[model samples]
Target: MKISDSFKSAIVEAICLLYILLFVYASVSKIIDFENFQVQLGQSPLLSAFAVPVSLGIPILELIIAFILLFPKFRYIGLMSSFGLMVMFTAYIFIMLYFSPFIPCSCGGILEKMSWNMHLVFNILLLMMAVCALLFFDKKSFFLRTKQFTVRLLLCTMISSVLIIILIFTFSEKIIHNENPFLRRYPPHPAEFSNAVRLKFNSYYLSGFADGRIYLGNYTTPAQIISFNSNLKDRKVHKIIFDPANTRFKVISWYVKGNYFYLLDGSIHKIFRGDIKTWKIDTELKDFPFFTRAIPIDSTTLVFRTNKGKKMTNTIGKFTNEQQVKVKYFEGLLQAQNEGVFDTDGVLMYSEELNKIVYLYYYRNGFVVADKNGKVENRGNTIDTIKHVNLKVSVLKNGTEYAISSPSITVNSSSTVYKNILFVRSQVKGRLENDQLWEKSFIIDVYDFRKNIYLYSFPIYHSSPAKKFSSFLATRTHIYALLGSDLVVYEIKNDLKKEMNSK
Candidate 1:
């Protein structure tokens, strides 16, 4: 259809007005809130490296384009520039929504409130208008000039290709490492409370697990050890036959290893050995170092986190030879934390299959992997970015010692290692996460110790009204969690089980 030049000129003039207004508003908004725009750019996955330059250059470019479109002489060049910019913006949004794992809030001005998908549509509409404006400028000249058309096509392709290449490079690195990107996958409820049994009291804590039965020790009644199977059907309470009156001993913790059960008393600095079947104490290991945290490695040996006599921070060590009870301290594990007493406080887990010790900290995104002999193996990271404890201390009692204002817990809330698979109840949430998913249950991030990489994460629902989880343990097939006074058992999802097996 042959359209009149007058009608085409009118359409082109209207398009020019749209471009001028759009650019003016966009540039003014960015200039007014320049620091915020700069920071948002700095957080972008693709623009982070060039944030400072781009932040300064963007508004200036927008203002220049706006002024150029306002003048009739420069309107043609302005339309072309606006078209290219809109195409670039559209591509950026598309890459962010699909390819990139982390999408930072960086769209400025009117685009800020719009969703990424909506912003893409808005850019696309503007791009179409820019193209139409250019086409209407001189209808016969643009179509008749083949050389001009070919040059413009090639220029657009090269610019678009470069933008895509940049997006690919930035997106690939984060997607592969899975770093702190905070991409969360919620599969069909990975875990659920299938069964639960009410205990005698809230004081009952899981002491150990062996032969599919969970053993519990009471702080109120130190002489009793309660045993219950995973099914919550069979229950037994055994009165621990130990001479507490003579030895002045108090049970700190207990665990089963091999054919025997060991009871540790940090107050008396002694460990008592007994048969698991009979629940009778027969042998005593004296001169054992005072340990706050203890985990049984084998029948004759045990691992502990202790601050024995010295003023040094807590050290990971093993005690073997029941007769002499020789303490071999791990020198390598003590130097990692700032203050070992509280900041380095964490869970000491032992994998029976690998015979490796994993110390997961409560105040950082790092953990220590060590061999049975206290040799350092490798240090690993959690998905969280918190590297140090967020603790505040104040001097008390005339500056002799400092008092902690708020005891900081930065990373792993609770963790357990079984068969080379590390299960952690993470306290810190990651990026690109759903707050509702975290609110419903405890987030359990699984890591493969052999690979030292995150495998997956699953949710374990809260069993009580308080929405607090005291302790949890994962076995080969089942997960036992102490939720208030009820012992809850959740079956591990088949896919997560397979993932762990593959690792």
Candidate 2:
């Protein structure tokens, strides 16, 4: 038996009414909580770069479709638009479920309460209703054979909608990581706080990790070394047996690698090497080039950064102390934007497993990866957009002493490198991120050094309001951070662990 024309018309009208209610409710809810909707979009892996425009466009477009569905003359067009939109929504959910690095909640109204799988089913049902309504509605005036032409058009619309989403997904990831517009993609629980230990003073810095223990050096007492076990439960204090009989040591730092620890005083051009078991300075080296920073690659080789040439520009070099000291400089490793001294200043990290040294610029967005012998390998950028240093330098009355005249913007504050991953503490804030979260925690951005791409970012929350992370070190299993007078440890979650294990 064939259905009556009146019955088909009634069916189409009922479906259109359902669509009108859904769109109107969703659009209004999005408008009511507009900031939250935009933030959800900013965290989306597929739409982060286009968050601002898409957040505003989606709700307005929904309202327009709802208004069109109210009129009989335009009901066919509205149904077609609704069908296309539902197809797009279904495709988005599928991609978010399978392909996206992290899923973000962006649905409006009561639909926000639905799981992604449930939302997928809901969109599919709405899509089927749209198709049925289109077939039953009056489309005879628009085409010669209404049913056949409508089916073809619907197929084309579905393909076009899916393609658009795919294109957006492809380009948005590239733009979000490389040409970022200050939008941060924060996945859930990339790192978790495990335990913390408080020190007596705030003058401690993370020296290094060696033999499954975390070592910290005190700035006030340079000879003292505080060590903690992997769990941060067992603590031991060891002092370096050194005597500064006649040498004036203005600054001193400790570095532990493998089985030996080195006490370096760049101001006095001295380096003392001691065995970890005895903590005795058995060897002392003098008359070395002045260096502001140093990291040991092995027992005999050390990479150092120092000012070179007549302009006092910063340069990185490696020296080998076998029978004599042999130094090699990679002058092009650091690029200067303004004053080379401050502009080129950054954190230096070395991965013993990968044999790669990374120089992360404090005032810029990128870092340079080089080999152990000072060979430039790959230059990778962080997710931020700051490419140049925001610094102002002035010469004092003496004309010889220079000082930073203005508060400079720091991009990558502190960093550490494990086997294949580089973890950087970012200082700049991104779009749609909560200000309160920034005030309460420090943001850590992770990158894959092997692929030269950003992996993800997470927050290391502060224990108290007055305490902030001063320095941090990353091991294979955990991250050790120095927050004010406290030493904190965080366990790496599986989401970050997978990226770290990737090539």
What TM-scores do the predictions have? Answer: 0.66, 0.94
Candidate 2 error regions (>4 Å)? 139-145, 396-400
lDDT computed for candidate 1: 0.74
The per-prediction tally of clashing pairs is 1, 0
What TM-score should be assigned to candidate 1?
A: 0.66
lDDT of 2 by residue, 165-276 (tens): 9999999999876677777778987778899988979999988888999999998988789899987999999978877679888778899999999988777776778899
Per-residue error (Å), model 1, residue 425: 1.4
Number of colliding residue pairs in model 2: 0
Clashing pairs in 2: none
Q: Kindly report which residue stretches of model 1 are placed more than 4 angstroms away from their true locations once superposed.
A: 1-178, 308-310, 322-324, 394-402, 463-467
